[model samples]
Target: MDKLMPQIESHIDFFLREKLPKSMPMVAMLIGDKTIGQIKEVFVSEISVLFPQLIGQYADGLLEDDRLYPMLTEKLQSAAVYSYISGTQSKLKGLFSKVKWGALVFGLIYGLLIGLIAA
Candidate 1:
């Protein structure tokens, strides 16, 4: 098992870097719970399909090892939080653009009204 641990860690690193984003939407579904079982379930049910060989090889270590599970959950949660923040930032940008345009229009109208009154 010691010999396999490094290999398992390397594989997990690759999975997080390469496949996690692609599977993020599905992984996000399991974000509420931070347990090893939930993390394992998400990986097994969703992420495994994307990289069967990697999951198959390391699934046991990922689920059963105390050290590995926390690492995996931390990575998963960070990804989910990043995705949520990015989505919110995008929405806020859109809203800010609209508000900016509205303010410009309001200013133009107010200026025109003032000009008419002055005239």
Candidate 2:
């Protein structure tokens, strides 16, 4: 073998330089115009622009679907809600206590007037 490696390398180079083009003509559309780096940049920019809106919508959907009803129910069932109602009731009771005698007299007069009117 008289320097077989160099001969093989020369033939391979010749094939790549000449025959490859004939066998496969370069198609610009098939090998897209944009580079991998350019594509990655566009993808990153688009995601950055849309990510917040997407996350907001997703969070809203989760709140509507999974949290609203339970949250309302929890509030309705909470001791704080009952305490608030009881606080109002206790205030009314305190007011009524201060005016029980007057209120009773007023009620009796109001009832007698209504009964007289009816009769």
Candidate 3:
């Protein structure tokens, strides 16, 4: 267990630094796609009542996808998202360090208690 700490920290650091940044674009795209879909669904019914069926579908495709997808993707990939992720990663690192120390202390105390009980 003592020898495992460095390995665990290294892997977690790698993931937070490397994999997360690389995956952000895809995550943004997915979020944009989902948001646009939901928005289109919400408005499409009202639009259909106001227009022909074909026109309504065309409006749905054009209005939401063309505008909202890029907007959402941009928003998701903006500085705020990255900053939030950075903040969370730092917090997680701090929490992990605390947990590591806590576990060590708990293990020592547990062992000492067991030894004293046996004696």
Count: clashes, candidate 3: 0
Cα lDDT tens digits for candidate 2, 1-119 = 23444564455545554565567667322433254335445645565567678989998897779668888788887868788998999999989887997889999999999999999
Quote the lDDT for 30 in model 3.
Answer: 51
- Which 10-residue window in model 2 sums to the lowest lDDT? 27-36
Task: Give the C-alpha miss distance for residue 104 in model 3, angstroms.
Answer: 2.1
Q: Candidate 2 regions off by >4 Å?
A: 1-34, 66-119
- Say which prediction, candidate 2 or candidate 3, comes out ahead on TM-score: 3
The prediction achieving the highest lDDT against the true structure is 1
lDDT of 1 by residue, 1-46 (tens): 4455556556655565557656786764544434534555565445
Over the stretch 8-118, how does candidate 3's per-residue lDDT look in tens digits? 445555554456557886654455445645644555444445546667789788787767888877888886878899899999999999999999999999999999999
lDDT of 1: 0.70
Once fitted onto the true fold, the runs of candidate 1 whose alpha carbons sit more than 4 angstroms away are 1-77
Indicate the residue-level lDDT of 93 in model 2: 94
Count steric clashes of candidate 1.
Answer: 0
- Which of the two, 1 or 2, has more TM-score? 1
lDDT of each: 0.70, 0.68, 0.69
Summing lDDT over every window of 10 consecutive residues in candidate 1, give the lowest-scoring window.
28-37
* lDDT (C-alpha) at residue 25 in model 2: 64
